[model samples]
Target: MEPVLRNLRIGRVLNEIKKVPNCMLLDVGCGFNHKFLSTVEPYIAQGVGIDFKVPNVSFRKIRAIQMKLNETMPFHNDSFNIATMLAVLEHLEKPKQILDEIARVLQDEGKLILTVPGKRAKPVLEFLAFKLGIVNRAEIEDHKKYYDLTDLQELADQSGKFEIVHHRYFQFGMNNFCVMKKI
Candidate 1:
């Protein structure tokens, strides 16, 4: 993703968390570089980042774990105030299960903030980012599917545990961000 777009998404997510002081967060698919955790550490009281591999370095407020999305999360029920899956849902084969798990781990009023590629803009991104070499092709290779707003809403509804609180298209409609509350 473009740096500006990535920052926009991250900034928006941070803004949401800022509404609640000293939040505890779960960051799914947080990569080995600890990029997201580093940015969020100072703001959050505590955080856990789970990915396929552990990060090389750890932050003071964040714990990194190596794990897959489809498997059961190690966390207990109602463990966190917020959960985030930035550009991650599309890469999971069993997204519904993951969504369910996210809901299971979040507190009753906890929020889920996520982003996925816009289905309608996939072709354009493929052309510009992959075909034209403007962006890294490998970065898009792991995506199992792209999601439109409807697909995301359906997944949230199917989870049977969350209610959409907010959603909108960002990055010129090439990406989507959604905030859901545990219900």
Candidate 2:
């Protein structure tokens, strides 16, 4: 991904989570770098990162777990105060199931922060990222779908356990950012 786009997404997520202090965060599909978790470590009290693969580096106050998003999360109920799934929801084959799991582990007052490629700009992004080689093709292939605001709202609705708190387009409408609260 382009640094500017990446910063926009990551920065938006970080900014939203910063409002809730001393939060225990669960970063779903945190990737091998634990990049997001590491970036937010200073603000959060504790954090756990789960992905299909292990991370290459470890940081204090953050635990890394290797687990696929499609499967049951290993944590118990009400395990976290905040949960984030940056750029991960569109790639899930079972997004509803995973959202259910995320809701299960989050406190009733917990918040979910996430980002996905905007449906309107996805095709153009694919063309630029893949054919033009402006972005990583390998990363683009991992996405099963791109989400517009409506699609994201529907997913939150289908979860039956969350209410959309905020939704907006960012990065010049190339991406969608959502903040949902467990209900």
Candidate 3:
């Protein structure tokens, strides 16, 4: 399959997988596009993809379904070795709840990977749009939250369960990438 945004998102996950070996993996908010599945294919023992919108299950190869992120993930306790929340947290109303759920389903030593927009990207872009009056901040559905380095760190640190292992600016050229790992 040709690469796209989903592929880009999954690439980040695959980069992190090199640090851990032979693990079960879950991709939260994996959509019908399944653009990123190929990245994780070779490394993960088993991969489960979940999203709210129904994705084309036929091509996914891995297990997938339509499910809400705010609700419970349908699996046993400590079901996965690693869980990735790529570009999904900023869209939710209650991101903390989802983080809590991720913690509950992950093994004590399991890892969680999170990526969101960098601090200035969203606000600067949105502010540019506001000047033109072409977009309304409230109407922008996908971005429910924005984070600077400090705020993102706090969110990951105070998750109630997970400890922040690594935090840094993930970048692809001029674009900013915010990467956080659950410890």
Against the correct fold, how does model 1 do in TM-score? Answer: 0.93
- Candidate 3 residue lDDT tens string, 1-98: 11354466566668887667777888887766654555677777777888887563644337776788778888898888788877676788887778
lDDT of 2 at 116: 86
**Which ranges of candidate 2 are over 4 A from the true structure?**
56-58
lDDT of 2 by residue, 1-183 (tens): 466776777888888778887889999999887878888889999999999876534568989988777888989999899999888888899999999999999998799999888887678878987789988887788878999888988998888899889999987787888999999
Question: Per-residue lDDT for 32-127 in model 1, tens only?
Answer: 766777897878999899998765345688788887777999999999999999988878889999989998999998999998888876788678
Clashes of each: 0, 0, 2
lDDT of 2: 0.86
Q: Each model's C-alpha lDDT?
A: 0.85, 0.86, 0.68
Kindly report which residue stretches of model 1 are placed more than 4 angstroms away from their true locations once superposed: 56-58
lDDT of 1 at 52: 86
Query: lDDT of model 1 at residue 91?
Result: 84
**What is the lDDT, from 0 to 100, of the residue 30 in candidate 3?**
73
Q: How accurate locally is residue 112 in candidate 3, as Cα lDDT from 0 to 100? A: 84
